[model samples]
Target: MIMAWWQILLLTCLAFWMIIDQITVGILCNYPLLIGFVAGIIMNDVKTGLVVGATLQLMVLGVGTYGGASMPDFMTGAIVGTAYAVMTGKGGDFAIGLAVPVGLLMVQLDVLARFLNVFLLHRVDHFIKLNDTKQAARNVVYGVFPWGLSRAIPVFIMLIVGEKFIRQVLAVTPQWLTTGLKVSGGILPIVGIAILLRYLPTKRFITFLIVGFIAAAYLKIPMLGVALLGFAMAIFYYQKTIKSSEDHESNSTVNNANGKEYENDKGEYEN
Candidate 1:
């Protein structure tokens, strides 16, 4: 299936915008859901785009590029995968299979972009030492190119070449492998959660975690309700901890004052 030239241009623009957005604006446009939605609009298949976007979003729910660490790039996946699915008349499962691997492969591209940014940083540093403020600012702005290209180049190539390549793969790939990819897509979200748990104060927050899980799993509470419950619990915990600390401080102050008074009386009596 031949994607229109305009469609290719639009997707590439989005890919570039999302990467720059992650770096500068941080308005979360780089997320899979938004990418998929826009991609769907471009591809004239909104429903399929939404489905692919949401699925990819879940797979990378807790994963982030924290501290410049590499994570799977669901944004790229959303664009390419959704396009592939819509073009090929494949469903969300097929899209997920295609997207997950694309996301994983893009991690290397992310690292390369970051490595290139180091040179820009050094240039900025040199300008700073020379006391050339304008050049320093210019160098900082120039840094956007490396990042934009890192995402945009691959997206362009994929949009042009991926449809045929994916069709070929699907044609030759065994049923078992296709099924496995779908299953792996479903399981991939757990990895994001596990990574998140590693950074969380699990023991400290375990009670809340369990409560949220139970509310959702057993009580059949909707996610919004569960989130509200969590919000209320957070406020209660904050107040309780603050009150406890204040009371302890007050008691310590009273005890110290009483001890000083007793010492003075004993000294006066001795004199």
Candidate 2:
């Protein structure tokens, strides 16, 4: 399964599925973590897959698309990253270095894909105007082709380029640059987190942030434990807030009833 055509085909199909799934079924197949896990399974290196995939996941933590905007193609990048990380055995750092640029490059391809979709939409409109339902439906379905191919073609080409090409590139790359890439890879998550915090209600939830930090740093709690702790805190706050709202509402209702029964200045009941 490692670096073979079938593996390449599977990875390419996964890339195709990632985009289409995002637009359609949305089973979270577009996430880097899942992409890496699947890529790792195909490459027979689940541990490496998780590491590389998780790293990429961190890199896109706060990244999202609004309106018609497209972000980096980290999902496809995860597929390449995991596959190459497994094949090269050069560690996740080196794989991270390779994966990121591919993501950036995909921004342009994403635009191209969107443009192609626009063209197809026009074709669909043309058919619709002519009252050709089948042609219009066919053109509508044809929109899948651009998006699917956008990721699939690059992934197939990258995978089929073989391990030899990657090794050869690595052989010529400077040691300092390679080390830098490793360091940069580790720092990427911090950048993502910084971006996320900037957009979040950090001041209001600063208590939770400090608690999470203490749990991870001082308590040395595992991520799952910290996550569970967060869940517990969320539930407590949610219930407390809901109860406060309900109590306020009840008090208001009682006040309104008393007001309704009270005598006005004219000695008449007023609502």
Candidate 3:
């Protein structure tokens, strides 16, 4: 697929907006799944976009940029991967292969963006002392440019490089390398899920977990059905737990009241 200038510009803009969205009005545009879906729509390949986004999203599950720490830029990976997957007509795994290095490389750019923003922060401080509120505010917005560009510039350049170049690179890539990518692509999500489970109270809800696994893996229940069942179970447990807590609190309150009454009555009789 020959990518038009408009498509490149649109995708670049989307990439630019995502980082700003992350720091400011976060509506989960920072998520790879949404990025991929939007990118796929731009490429006229929603399936590829969804597949790429979903795979990367799973891989990044339980991963965070907490406390200003940067994780791999999988969101960009989804955009590039979805675009190239559509353009190259390659498999989702091949797209994953293309995305892995790009995501890792973007990490350095992410750090660079933050480091550049430090200067803006300093300027904001200076303006605070000078009371030039407008310049400080402008600089604050200016700070978003580096962060946006860190993602946009690379995606724009890469997309403009065209499908011919991508096909050529794929032609030169070894079968073993591609195979490895497919395997790793599948494995990474499991690792992400494992990481997620580690932080969840899995032991307390082990039965639910076991049942879900059985329903999905053995019974081959549709994911939607499995999800609904899980929801029902969660609601049931939540209501039951609340009821028990309320009962315990009521009993405690009654016990305390009876004890106080007993003490008062005994003191009156002694008097």
Candidate 4:
């Protein structure tokens, strides 16, 4: 499963693009599914790419690098994992298992990139104080290098040398550990869901959750059907709540106006 030089170059470029897109453009090119698909195209294996990408996507869904917090780098995982999977003829499960550790390892790289960007920020600030507008703008553009290299260097190394490392590790690793890794991969997505639930109004949405679970578990409804049901419920709730609030406000306004008019009439009669 030797990767051609062009394939390695393409992957390196994808890695660079992912970080730059996240830090500057924010076009969601860093997302796992997209990364996987592009890697798949580069490797001439779209199906494997989709499977690997979707698996990583599910695992990291709803987990974000909000407030400068570091999370697993699923984008790198997807690109590397999909390439490895396609090259080695390993199934999606192995790719998924590989992704967890790869993503976790990438967290350090992400932090390093951010830390380096701080220096760039300082340089930009210095230029601003000197009133060098052109230099300040150039400094901002220069920040992209650290971020891009942080991702690209690791990806290039992995694509170039990772196959032999993976094969060697797989040969010596126990079967039980391998199975556990696969199981852990399957379970990791629940952590993402739990993180999402922490921010939700769980008590208010508990009933809907129960209904959805039942629909999926017992009634065997497809995910699309469940999603549509949820959408309908949201629309219904929004309309009902809005109408009730509007009616209450309208009634209050009318009653206040009528009471004022009655008071004026009574005062005139008394006078």
Clash counts for the predictions, in order: 0, 0, 0, 0
Residue-level lDDT tens digits of model 3 in 128-223: 999999999999989989999999999999999999897787799888988898887777778878988998899999999999999999999998
Alpha-carbon runs more than 4 Å astray in model 4:
162-165, 265-271
Model 1 ranges with Cα > 4 A deviation: 1-4, 37-69, 115-140, 162-165
Off by over 4 Å in 3: 264-271
Q: How do all models score by TM-score?
A: 0.79, 0.93, 0.94, 0.87
Best by lDDT: 3
Cα lDDT tens digits, model 1, 1-271, are 6689899999999888898997787875657998899899999999989988987887666665679799888989999888888878767877888898888888999899999999999999999999999999999999899888988998898888756786887899999988887787667666667767887788898999999999999999998999899999999999999999999999999999999999999999999
lDDT of prediction 4:
0.85
Where does the lowest 10-residue lDDT sum fall in candidate 4? 57-66
Candidate 4 C-alpha lDDT tens digits along 12-131: 999889978977778765579988888899999999888888878877666666788998888988888888888778677778888778888988987998899899899999999999
Model 2 weakest 10-residue run by lDDT? 262-271
Model with the higher lDDT, candidate 1 or 4: 1
Better of 2 and 4 by TM-score: 2
TM-score of candidate 3 against the unseen true structure: 0.94
Report clash pairs, candidate 2: none
In candidate 3, where is summed lDDT lowest over 10 consecutive residues?
59-68
